[model samples]
Target: MTIRSSWSRAELGAFGEQVAVDHLQAAGFQIVCRNWRCRYGELDIVATDPASRTVVFVEVKTRSGDGFGGVAEAVTRDKLRRLRRLASLWLAGQDRGWAGVRIDVIGVRVGNSPAPELTHVVGVG
Candidate 1:
């Protein structure tokens, strides 16, 4: 595999988002959208959990190393607050209704192994 350090931040994030998407799909979630953006911010991935019939808003953080902090730590309470608002905005634009809504965080760490490492925190909101 190519070295993670060689990739730019955008590239790394894009790769990580793809990884997160694949992981979610494998875990039985139906992907609704990826990289949903608005004036306030962006939602990395949006999915529907078939079992729960809920809309899932995902935030993905990608890092080559823990120089700053763990990938999950990149998302703070303030960030989650903003995410809730963003999720509302996204939900407003949707035509279908969900049983409930949830916010999740997926952290991707690369460069140390042959494949990327992912951590999923469900119902963070």
Candidate 2:
């Protein structure tokens, strides 16, 4: 986990997405896409859990400090609703279907520390 002292919002967000992807792959999830976007919104990460045969939609929030409250506060109900709708739209374009679907959120906190912190919440909303 290399931590930089400074980062722009886009850089931080992209770095966080990569960190989230690494975490998910380590947990045995197969990554399907990153930054999947449509007319509705964006899905940070799309993956499949072979063990559960489920499709997972991930939203990543990267923060440099405590400015944003926490996981829940970072992802609001309206955001979750938009994610749900986005997930459905993404699924519609897929050629295959899964037995289940889930929403996950990964929060990446990067500051002047040596390493960034990560919080992964599964099945959000």
Candidate 3:
């Protein structure tokens, strides 16, 4: 396995998103979309939790190291606000009824280890 420390910032981010997707799928989430974007911003992943019949909007944050802060700290209040707006835009474009909507954040920490550390925060906003 390739460690996160070897990748560039952009590559680390993309790798983290893929890891997040895999984690969600393993947790029984059906992926609806990936990298959905608009004028507002971008959503990393859109998934449905079959058990609760809810639409989940996911934001992915990745860091090769924690020099600045931990991966979770990267998600600021402004980010959450933007995510909420983006979620509204997504809902507006949807025709089906959703039981509910939620915002989640996946934080990935990449280092010299073979596998990166992943932290999932649910219903963050």
Top candidate on lDDT is 2
Against the hidden reference, what TM-scores do the models get?
0.93, 0.96, 0.93
Model 1 over residues 1-125: C-alpha lDDT tens digits?
A: 34455897889889988899999999999999898899999998999998989899999998898896885678898999999999999999988999999999999899888889889999888
Misplaced by over 4 Å in model 3 are none
lDDT string for model 2 (1-125, tens) is 57778788888888988999999999999999988888888899999999989999999999899877877799888999999999999999999989999999999888846777899998997
lDDT of 3: 0.88
Which prediction has more favorable lDDT, 1 or 3? 1
What would the C-alpha RMSD of candidate 2 be, to one decimal place?
1.1
Judged by TM-score, which candidate is best? 2
Q: What would the per-residue lDDT of candidate 3 be over residues 1-125, giving only the tens digit for each residue?
A: 46633677778888899899999999999999999999988999999999999999999888777776865687799989999999999999999978989999888877746787898999998
Supply candidate 2's per-residue lDDT for 123. Answer: 91
lDDT of each: 0.89, 0.90, 0.88
Q: Ranking under lDDT, best-scoring first?
A: 2, 1, 3
Write down the RMSD of candidate 3 (Cα, Å): 1.4
Ten-residue region with minimum lDDT total, candidate 2:
108-117
Candidate 3 lands at a TM-score of 0.93
